[model samples]
Target: MEYEKQTEHKHHHVGYGTLILIWVALIALTSITVTIAGISLGSYTLFVALFIAAIKSSLVINIFMHIKFDEPIFKVFLIVSGFTLIVIFILTFSDFIYRG
Candidate 1:
């Protein structure tokens, strides 16, 4: 019996230009977060910083980590993990606030 060889599927390649663009955007977001930290936004400062950080993380994970091309289950797991993290952060913050 002869065994058939399976053909490999070609994966999508991200161009250097696309990577550079993402890097630039990440840098810009970092700068904006730092600038925001300097100004007095009261309690909103943490929220703004975390929001920017989340955007940066999403870009890094989806583009750099190739999560965008991954399977649907991976995306679903990512969402679930993110939701769990948010819940944990909220609980921790709430506990700290209540304790103080």
Candidate 2:
């Protein structure tokens, strides 16, 4: 019974106003991304777009997915997965760079 108590899940409640704000922020970021795409910043354009996309994804994961309120293990798993993806991206880009 004691172990059960320690392992119990938490209930995270988000307000309607907070959700609305997040939605607005997401819309604004999307608009900015679209506008940036048309501006043509040269090589820096891709990096800028990726940075903005990363922010948008994080907000979706933390708020919409409710990952922020979950257990620490889940958070660890997310970090590990993200790290793996980054490593894959790096390796792929490196190979592309060397092939040319």
- Per-residue lDDT over 1-100 for candidate 1, one digit per residue giving the tens place of the 0 to 100 score: 1212211121346778889999999999999998998999988888899999999999999988877866678899999999999999999889876895
Q: Candidate 2, after superposition: displacement of residue 95 in Å?
A: 2.5
lDDT value for candidate 1?
0.85
Candidate 2 lDDT: 0.84
- Output the worst ten-in-a-row residue range by lDDT, candidate 1: 1-10
Residue by residue across 1-100, what tens digits does model 2's lDDT show? 7645543443236667878998999999999999999997987898899899989999999888877877788899999999998899789878976885
TM-score of each: 0.83, 0.84
State the lDDT at 91 in candidate 1. Answer: 94
Q: How many pairs in model 1 have backbone atoms within 3 A of each other, for residues 3 or more apart or on separate chains, i.e. clashes?
A: 0
| Candidate number achieving the greatest TM-score relative to the actual structure | 2
The alpha-carbon lDDT assigned to residue 66 of candidate 2 equals 74
lDDT scores for all predictions? Answer: 0.85, 0.84
